[model samples]
Target: MIGNIFLFIFATGALILLNKFLAAWLPKRNPKEKYLSKAETLVFIIFLLIIAVTIESYDVNSSVSVFTIGIMVPRQGKTHRTLIQRLSYPIHEFVLPVYFGYMGFRFSITALTKRYYIGLVIIVILALAGKLIGVICACMYLKIPKKYWLFLPTILSVKGHVGVLLLDANYSKKKWWTTTIHDMMLASLVVTTLVSGVLASFLLKAREKDFAPQKTCLESHDTHEELRVLSCVYGVRHARGTISLISALSGCHGASKPFAALLMHLVPLPKKRKSSELLYHELGDDVHGDDEFGTNDGLEINDSIDSFAKDSKLLIQQVKLVTKMLNMHVEICNATEDLRISIVFLPFHKHQRIDGKTTNDGEIFRQMNRNVLRHAPCSVGIFVDRNITGFQQPHGFDSVQHVAALFFGGPDDREALALCRWLANNTLIHLTIIHFVSEDSQTESPVRNTTTQDNNDVFIEVAGRDQTEHEADRSFLEEFHNRFVTTGQVGFMEKRVSDGPHTLTILREIGEMYSLFVVGKSRGDSPMTVRMKDWEECPELGTVGDFLASSLDVNASVLVVQRQRHSHDNFLDD
Candidate 1:
């Protein structure tokens, strides 16, 4: 009996460490990997079924005693044991406690009237106090968020299993001292578990009220620079990923159709060649071919042979060149290193038509799955002028005010900077360009803010504290003062550095507050297509985009911009 008691006590201590490890491991598993095999599931279900039937059989004492025997069921093999171990936790954490607590509540007062009473009270108090101290230690170590503190005590409060185990000992013991100790311990376990559960639940609710809110700053000002906007510039491989406010106003008009058409228009087409008579421009001249093709090198390329075999590679290269000539941002990369190519391409296949033309939305969305979803960047968004959804356009501010511009080095970021430039130079909108510098960049691309004399309005924040950190990584935070907190010119333009949750988080937080969430369309489908493709490479965004899309809390209006290609009268007609 003494050995059995000692073993149970040691086992409970081991369970504490095991439970902590399980808690950390469970949250990280992929959904498919989180569960046990079908065979294990079946075994657990069968055990649970038997336990349920036994508990309801009205033989309460025997039913409770059977738990020990039940856990010792014949293991089919190591795999079966592993599965049983995985499945046991759910029953141990939830099912077993409730039954034990209820059973404890039914303890007889008459049976406790003898020598067992004092020992039971003492055990109960010690168990409860020990659990409380453990919980407090956990709280301190975890820095448990105030809103969640009430929940902490409940996690520690469970004492029913120990109480049930004590019951078996009480029955086996014949001596007064041994029986009394068993009864007292059993009683204490019951009282401590119940009291702990209630107190923990209440405290958790209290902590939740004090939960710290995430903080971000947003600012906006009146500007006269007309918002240069484009929607769904890049091609989206999958049209289904888009969520356009325009889609909402359109009254459930399939988002994919318009979204696909919007993307095709965004794909930068190859530049067209004009007849030889056009005047030469100094910029973008073909320096490499000047000696081979004479003065009018472009004029000698009319032969059938040149057109037939036509080094398909050269044509493609020329097409790419022309596309860049059209001012489309084109980046050539080693396709082998990054097997995934993330581009905001037309979401609809070329065959589908929209607006009296074919559309590509359906084909892209339906075919998308985990393997291909990350292989190619696939998010789609449609931009329409008239509210497809009931979104109202913002009216220009006639009162004239201040503006702040965020400087990040992407298309949308540059556009935001351009908007600020336009506002500062051309309109009533007072503009300040705020660039966040990291400690590493401070020594390299250091913006001598000393150039500005306007101390009241102009501001720059260096987000990084240490000098050794990567310049690209640092975010600027104003350390001592909320200088721009009340300033009217202070504005925040949401800039997505890469495809990730931070973009969504920044978008949701600043989306409604800013006059616009300045985002650059792929110039290539929907704004999200390029963004999502970029996200595929990032571990954080790939995990979070699905959840954020379903969340009710996010708020923001997306403004996508496509850079206009510079064209002249000499351009090809097609």
Candidate 2:
């Protein structure tokens, strides 16, 4: 029996190791990742079959080898990892249900007698209390916030699939425990898991009110104060463009109070069973050497900090080289709530591939953007890089960097103009404000016309008022032009493109002339925007910004800005 058990263990271990070796080898052996992913999937299935055979032949009581082999498989790259996740979706959705259902069938409810009921209640209470107490104690020792005390305990108490597997293993071994005790434990597992899930849901709903501050941060910000901006970059490739935008917004051109920039490097969490601490420790000896601005508070510390620490160590070395040359005071850290900043800058997910076709990194980046937008403490800007290699001059230099700002009159446009106002301070940057006035703004609607003279007088008065409002808009633009458009510093250009096709043509022509394009996100009932809406591929880039960023002929990097929604009341005055 002992020899058979050893043989089973040896065979399964060998197959798992072989599977890992092949997975690593196949990718190198084949250039096409699609073919390699298929080959890796086949190898995984073969190892699982071999483990099953070993278990049957040796008459092993547990199927723990299945779980062990899964953990043993190495994730090679994003393509390989994504393929594995896609392949396992069916098993997780369909097969797990059958397996768990079969386990449920073996559970005998009749075994729960009065005597066993007492033990079952005791087991459930103890399981809940023990798990909750242990996690709460750990959280307290770590100085975690009190708001998360109940939430962490509730989530940690969830037994989930592992609990089912353990119970099934015990039930398979008939003599492992007495029948009544085994049945009671299984019932307790079900009860505690359900209770924990309910508690977690309740805690999450109750915590929603605490997030109110995120909405208020932008509204309360004073534009006259030193601008505090938090810029988030996913990789080193995006660092240059993000820093450029920050430099432009920072008013880095000999300003008395320059912008304070906090560079937040974002990274996806590591795969399952991987220790983030180990990853950080292996990064280098000088991991925490430059983290002067980062805090040691345990409340904000989590697994993400390890990734942040690792990425920050790498990013600081690169960012410092640029920030130092620019003479900017920049702090590098992970994107977290510990630091409060007014504006957050994020890079667009899509990147131009070797074949010239654009591809996004993955849904992870898109989801990250959505989360930031949903809960960001202030205004956010998503920068789409078109690899504009034309304007490589250092920001605030005397060399001309032409910037085009698209304005159509909305809160977003106002915000974009405000940002340009800051950029206009630099003597090197020549700013062009392209004001697009749609045909709808010039014409009054006939829908409200009436035959009565009194009604006609009222309608005429309203039409006159509408014309006066249009004049006010023009007056505002004139004031803007008078303020910025001095001799050779700023230029104001107006385009009266009525239809969408005409607007696109005008934008295409204007886009070719500029090194950078800044545009608002909202269209504000503009007829030109309505006409161009059909051509919008990515609405997240807004209309004009998307057209410029996606157009091959544009040749300009785009900055799409959206003002915080709650700040419209305060910002409209500007």
The prediction achieving the highest TM-score against the true structure is 2
For candidate 1, lDDT tens digit of each residue in 1-574? 4664454445444444443344334423422232335654465456445544544343233333345444444222223334555657877798877866766565555567757666667776777667667877777896664445445556656645544654653244255545445545556766777877777666656664353222100112112211211122232212122222212211222211111112112233335544546455642354333222221222221121122112211110011112331233212111111222112222212222233232333332323322122231222222221122112321134633333344433333343343333333323343444443222221433232333333322333333333432232222222101233233434332222223344455445533343323333322232222344543421211222222222234232222322222121112222
TM-score of 2: 0.47
Q: Write the per-residue lDDT of candidate 2 for residues 1-574, one digit (tens) a residue.
A: 8887787778778877887677556655544332345655666677688678657665565467777777776533322443454667787889898987887887899988888888888888898888878988998897776778888878876756877777655344567577667778888999999899999888878896553244333323444555667776655556556655655665534556435666654443333433446676686743543332222221122122223323322111112111221112112212323354566777787875555567878766665565555444356677776554433334335556788888776666666776777677765677887766554343532213232432112211111224554554455555566667634467665556556688788877766788888887766455676667777877777777778778877777778887765332233242
> In the order shown, what is each candidate's alpha-carbon RMSD?
26.0, 19.1
Off by over 4 Å in 2: 1-224, 275-338, 353-357, 390-398, 443-479, 486-488, 566-574
Lowest lDDT 10-mer window, candidate 1? 312-321
Error of model 1, residue 253, in angstroms: 44
lDDT of 1: 0.34
RMSD of 2: 19.1
lDDT of all the models against the reference? 0.34, 0.61
User: What local lDDT does model 2 show for residue 250?
Assistant: 50
